[model samples]
Target: MKGNKGLIFLSLMPWLCMEADAAQHWADTSAGVRWSSSFREPYNPEKVSKTILNVTHVSQDDYGRNFLFMDYYISGMEDPSKDNATGAEEFYGLYRRTLSYNALAKDPIDSSWVKDVHLSGRMDVGYENTQLSPRPFKVRMGGLVDFKIPKGSLEWGLEGVYQKSYNGITHRHFEFDPSFVTWMSWNYPVTKKSQFSGILEYLEAIGEDGFGNDTKPLTIFRANYIYDIGQPKGFKVGVGYEQFNNKYSSNNAADPTNGSDQKTFVLLGSYHF
Candidate 1:
């Protein structure tokens, strides 16, 4: 049944990422592991032949910026008698509450046009075993904006998420009204220490997941190019690119979500304290 519940939640994904890093007590943290493959093209598992394990935590004082992450997906060619993978693993978190980056850095100071803002929220959970839509849960209540990029070393941002969805039991959709995803992220430098981060998204789930099945408009993109191994509590290395276009996807065993496209590329490294 859905590959025995995705092999019992992928064997509790390393004790749930070490109990979410002991309930986030490590403060500003970053732990990583990623290994991707697809040399010479021709790899496909819907578009990923993966291996990844990540854990991240970030913080900001004045109660206005927090991030948490957990990811674990292993199945470059697992079999377990078939059905690919069950609940690969994805856990996320976000919280922003800067109330305006200390009032836009104390009195405008030459209006370069707002370079800080906040009030963001997000929570995600995904577990899979796969028989067409294994498990999903998302909650995002957002609002974030940052601008004022002037000359190199950029780090732009924007977001507006408002999606609340929960489904499983091989859903099919029918719960309308409640899906809005807008995203933008950046990190451009390409010089001192090298840089080139990325993220782009646009999603609006068109309701239908209880067996009525439906989903069409979706877009996702990613880019990467990192370099900086000058430790002292920072180390990076990257080369990534990702793409997703969903005509609809439930696993696409025929027409689950009606795939539109899929792409992948990766080779990244990280270390941050």
Candidate 2:
């Protein structure tokens, strides 16, 4: 997967768009850490009541913006019902190339609705357990659109997801199977040092479950309220809530077709350096 960069870029063809206008170099970089409780995931039949530590990074360059996060589960050993096994590690990242809104539309339409767009790529890699995701990697490529609001921005994106089966091969290869994924996001400044943000996503799966069954579409939601802690916004704190309508796997007790509903509370902090 490390050397298959060409294949990944080609897979993004349908979702690609124009490039951003900026200097051709790195712009900003930052790192931070966080913790969340009672997290639930697609593979879990129920909530994995545990504490997890997350290390994260963010970078912006002339080409686009990128984000990376690594999570290590702690406190899942005593809970047999947890989807997150003890010591499980998970990683995910997104890289996006900003697209100029005016260039794509040449006509100079209203500035209120369309502000910007981007060609984006993303990947997720996770260490599995009986309760969480079985697939080691999931990759996606698409374009994201941004809209202008009074005091904030809204973004929507659609991507073609490439996912491999848990037992596909020795290493996860390009399934190139066309599964669907899309997201909607929002951010608004509430005050000089505070903001509100949220995201919603629809995930379509192409993996099989026990008895060789396919699961249903799932909806994931995460929302956060953040405040800058000090001068120049060097540190931050946030309170958030996250939820899933159904998991990716077919393990819902009430209705297997819909999967299980999961929710969690998140407490987070981060520093820019």
Best by TM-score: 2
Among all candidates shown, the one with the greatest lDDT: 2
lDDT of each: 0.55, 0.62
lDDT of 2: 0.62
lDDT of 1 by residue, 135-253 (tens): 44454555666666764323334443333344455444323345677777777787888778887877776566456656555677888888878963787877898776663333233
Cα lDDT tens digits, model 2, 208-259, are 5433556667788989998889953388888888888766544455464332
Model 1: residue 119 alpha-carbon error in angstroms: 12
Q: What TM-score should be assigned to candidate 2?
A: 0.73
